[model samples]
Target: MNKYIIYLIALVSGVLGVFAFSPFDYWGLAYVSLLGLIFVAKTSKKSTALFASFLWSMGFFCFGVNWLNVSIYQFGGASLGVSYFLVGLLSAYLALYPVLFTYLVQRFNVQSAVIFSVIWTFTEFLRGWLFTGFPWLQLGYTQIDSPFSGIAPIFGVTGLTFFTVWASASIFNGVAALFNGKNPKIALFNAVLLAGVGGLSAYAQRIDFVKPVQNEPLRVTLLQGNIEQNLKWDPDYLYSTLEIYQKLIAQHLGKSDLIILPESALPTLENALVPFFERLDRAGQAADTEIVIGTVYQDVHSDKLFNSMVSVGNPNFPYRLETLNRYSKRHLVPFGEYVPLETLLRPLNSVFNLPMSAFQSGAVAQPPFMAKARVFAPAICYEIIFGELVRQNLKNDTDYLLTISNDAWFGNSIGPWQHLQMARMRALELGKPLIRATNTGISVFIGAKGEILAQAPQFVETALTYDIAPMKGKTPYSVLGDMPLYGLSLLFLMLRGMMAFMRRRMNLSQKP
Candidate 1:
């Protein structure tokens, strides 16, 4: 086969793999993508390693996250050319992670192929954590429907990602060695070892923690309120937006015990929502429901604005103004939510013309939302990806996980599916039933075992109603967190660096 053709096939295969594991299919495209990268990298000449890595990453991100075009064109009001350019730029930036990983792997002439793979994973693990973490495309999320998902409970998503990369790299190296007419015995043995470890992971998935002793189900009405992102900020659309959500709630008001809304469901400013709250409070009172709606609230004490989840009508306090069961969003998006290096980036903001160009960060240690007898752990949109953040917020008695997001930004891309995949990981790791409310679709109710019990289609303006039992059982991840994986990954990186240094020293000594 022509070398150019091999590289092209690898790129196409990687792109196809992304679609397979996406919402359209569950055949493990994520795993295939990682494997495809290794194959592509293997075909490259040593001189072209960096270029090959870049090409693989570009193919993976550009095709996998093409949904960014939706925001740039549909929401940001940019032209097709501009949207394409922006998407390409962002994907290229994401691609750098794989390039850096491949670069480091080549520098360390490690004897064990498995060890090399682990080092590759250690870089990926760091990419997901260091610098507020952009774990958008972690490999383990692809295993959501695979047998290996069971490993998540034992070792968070990072560990699973590390293991997947390690195994894939080992197999790739072993196969290449065989093709090159080298002694295939060592490679064959390592391949068998990888298979054995993978089988163990499959078996481990069957394990479950103790079930909740006394399960109390929470009847949740998740509202999608599929509002147009562009019109959401328009003052004229405020009443219509408020009416649409109010009407949706009216239909299921008495039917559900707790009603939920997507993030920033209130299209108005913080102060402007006071009147809307009065209406919601009255509706909750008349309909006999406790409501948790997403709104922007201004904290007078700190003079800061927050993306908050406010509660309306606690039945116990009939006459009292309903207090907020607020969860201020901790993980704010870089350009969309808050501009980093504000003075420098603020200029680019006007050029790109992003909506809500700035938002303040909320305290990480804020208390969980108090709803009826249950305390709900909340994560706003992007916050769901951080395993440590979720683990930290999980109180011993916190009954369930609640995430509110506006998928209008992601549009009809694999981005929503990727987001859903990551969220499911949280459900698996913590063994908690998750209630996800989104604007413009994917309003879902996920079981503790990471099963999507119920969900609404994307781009559909609808409310998804479901009842889930909030169980109190902690999975291994919930108990131990990512501490072990972090320590091990760090040690591996240090060891790789030390090995590289020793190899260079040995070469100098031998030459003398």
Candidate 2:
């Protein structure tokens, strides 16, 4: 096949993966996408395969995250061309991960499924970690609703990613070998391994890893303020935004044991909003309710500002100006939350001057919020997308996972749905029920099994109330967060190195 044609096919394969994720959820396309990349790596020259992989990932990211343009162009006061250029630039940079993976596979002539997955795991990990990380659109997220989701509790998302790649390679190698009337033994082994993973997943799904804390569920209300992104940070409209959420909280105060608010539900700095929060604290105390709400926190002691969430009421936990009863977001979005190289970039564009974009991260070891007799580990906005970060923050007694986001930035785009999907995966991985409250919109109560119990519609101002049971016990993933996968990956890496060295030796000796 022509190399350009191969690259196009590779690119199309990646584009297909977009439909496999959120709002579409055709999970099988992930396998198909990997198969196409595998074909490119196997059939094309090393250089061509590496470039083809880059094109493939380019197709995946450009279409998958195009919603970024909505925020950059519409909200950030940037021109359409600049928005497109920024998104394209980010997509192009991310595509490099797949290119490195292809280079390793082609250079080493890796055939073992384990070795292939090892390379894949490292590349994907590096992509998410290097330079504050952008772990969006990982392969494991597509399997959240699939039977393979069962693997999450054992090995987490990276494990599911390994299984996906392993199974795809098994299908490709086994079917091809069988058709060629060769390597029957290898084909049988691949077939059995593929079937084994499926069987294990189905079996694991039937077994309950955690149980509800009590027979009676906790009455929880998730508030979706549906505040417009443009007006959220406006000083003129801050009170209007606060009033909307205040009304929502008032309506649910006595009725629900816990009322959750979206990220930045109140757009003012925490220090500036003390009196307002004091009223909320007093109201919740009077009603015997606990409220978890997101806001911007600027410390009085320092110039530091944190994107934070705090709980009001439940005498044990009071609304405070400090980090007490608070979970400040750790994983801050690069340009969206805080501008990097501010001296160089801030003056160049309005995108860098986005309202409330200059914020610092909180401490890494902060305790989870205690609400309504259940412990909750919170992830604010972009934090939930990082599986390892979420895992690291989990505690032994964590009952429900909490993430509050403001997705209006990507208005009416698949971005919100995709964000919700990743949150579900976190719920699945930890074997814990989840409370996801979002601004404009997608407020949801996700079950411990990663099922959506209730959801508020997008762009709607609404509150969803449900009696969510707190879960007890730790998922294997909680006990061992991706360490097993990394161990296996390291072993595979050493094996591949030895194999490659032997192959070179054999080639040099046979040259005579």
Per-residue lDDT tens digits for candidate 1, residues 145-199, read 7767778888878777767777777776777778888898968887788788778
Model 1 CA lDDT for position 134: 79
Q: Candidate 1: misplaced stretches above 4 Å?
A: 1-6, 26-28, 40-43, 182-184, 213-215, 285-287, 316-324, 347-352, 490-512
Each prediction's whole-model lDDT (CA):
0.76, 0.88
Worst 10-residue lDDT window, candidate 2 = 315-324
Off by over 4 Å in 2: 179-181, 316-318, 496-512
* Candidate 1 weakest ten by summed lDDT: 316-325
lDDT, candidate 2, 1-512, per-residue tens:
89999989999998998988999999999999999988888779987898899889999999999999999999999999999999999999999988998898888787787777888898999988899888889888899889888898888888999988888888778877888898799899998998888999999888899988778688999998888888888899987887898888999989999999889888888788899888999999999998888888887889699898888877765667874778888888998888899999999989999888889998999976788877888899899988888887888778788899999999989998899999998998899998999988888999988899998888889999999888888888888889988998898788778878899999999996
